[model samples]
Target: MNNNSNLSSNNNKILNTIDTVMGVKEEKEINQQQEYPPLNGQKLLIYVMGTLAQIGFMTLTLWLINLGFKQLLEYNLDVRINTIIVSLFWIFFTIRSRLFSPLDNTRSRRQYDQVIRPKWAPPAFVFPIVWISIGVLRVVSSYLVWQELNQNFLALPLIIFTIHLALGDTWNTIFTVEGRYGLAVPVVIIGPLLSSFVLAYVYGQILPLAGWLIFPSCIWLMVASVLVINIWQLNQKD
Candidate 1:
């Protein structure tokens, strides 16, 4: 059996949604008091594959942003590099989610939250401070094609989603401490999807593009995110 029972049912309900997305099997314990299964060689392989999938997804995200900047905004070099830097930090932290777990009261964890998250958060915080800054970053970074390429209002959703991704760990810690971390997977995924769609609509108004890609983008993200998580899950057997 696996550690699903260790998670709260509420959290499991959310995790169930991720299970639907990733097709992960329930690792039920033979006895209620039984421990999670020990990891083995086969499961480790599966875990690594899942991790690689996540890495590839982040890389693809980088490429998509690059394509949008060049094709739509006609911006190059510094713009692409800056955008990539932001995305890299975002993806880097996300992939290292375990390392940043709020439960991680380790010295390294403090360093990451204080030193690391701050390093990345500033430029992004400044991202929406100016109209052009908001326009350049949010417009193309978001999937909306219709949003204006140079406007202030577009920062609304972009700002929130960024905060959500960053603060999600804090929320998870709260849930875990409250005896509810089990359902972390689903809530994390769905919350972002909803916020993302809203952000897309906001971006559409400011700098409109094809609205059709919004849902598709969400699905892709779901699949991509699950694929990445599955990697770590596979290692749980170890």
Candidate 2:
């Protein structure tokens, strides 16, 4: 009876100590009120899905533009040269997305005071011109891929990778920014990006010389591995 009582007392003391260290308590003591709920994952996921579908459809329509470009340009340009152009455009797009996306925000309240663009803003009408320039790069990438690859198969891989990118940033940004369990999100996203390059290497650049049909299958296996691992981590709830 005495041992049981002692153990109960010790456990209570430990819990109190932990709670004190963590600063968890009734809300009234806080100097400035921060009315925020815990990150509800289910809600975040629904928003993410909507965003992902938009990105997927946008990418597909963009790809059709590429197909048209390929018919006009012909596949005369070297694949490596095309890849270089795609890389540069991707960099520009990434920068623009970071700069402009209203969905790419954090905090519950609008901190309009913190939002500011760079000093080297072009003329008053520069925004539309800048946007159109980046749009051309995206269309050209689609066209190059369609021209270089005979089948429409290139669209499938591009869609998969873009979905992966869209999901990674959405989940990562939404949760991590809100102090939620966004474990290894960067690693998860980066692993797939690297896999895309590997797939391009094995299938697009090498398989023809190797005289093999297994490259596509192998590339898919890598993608599956990434998805499985990430899903497992998400399910583990940490």
Residue lDDT tens for model 1, 89-182 = 4444333333423242111111112222222133321211222232234334553331333322124444443433434333333222221222
lDDT: which candidate is best?
A: 2
Candidate 1 residue 6 C-alpha distance from true site, Å: 44
- Whole-model alpha-carbon lDDT for candidate 2: 0.43
- Clashes counted in candidate 2 amount to 2
Regions more than 4 Å wrong, model 2: 1-36, 67-102, 105-154, 182-238
lDDT of 2 by residue, 63-84 (tens): 7646754663586677677656
* Candidate achieving the largest TM-score: 2
Judged by lDDT against the true structure, how good is candidate 1? 0.39
Q: Among all windows of ten consecutive residues in candidate 1, which has the lowest summed lDDT?
A: 104-113
Provide TM-scores for the models. Answer: 0.30, 0.38
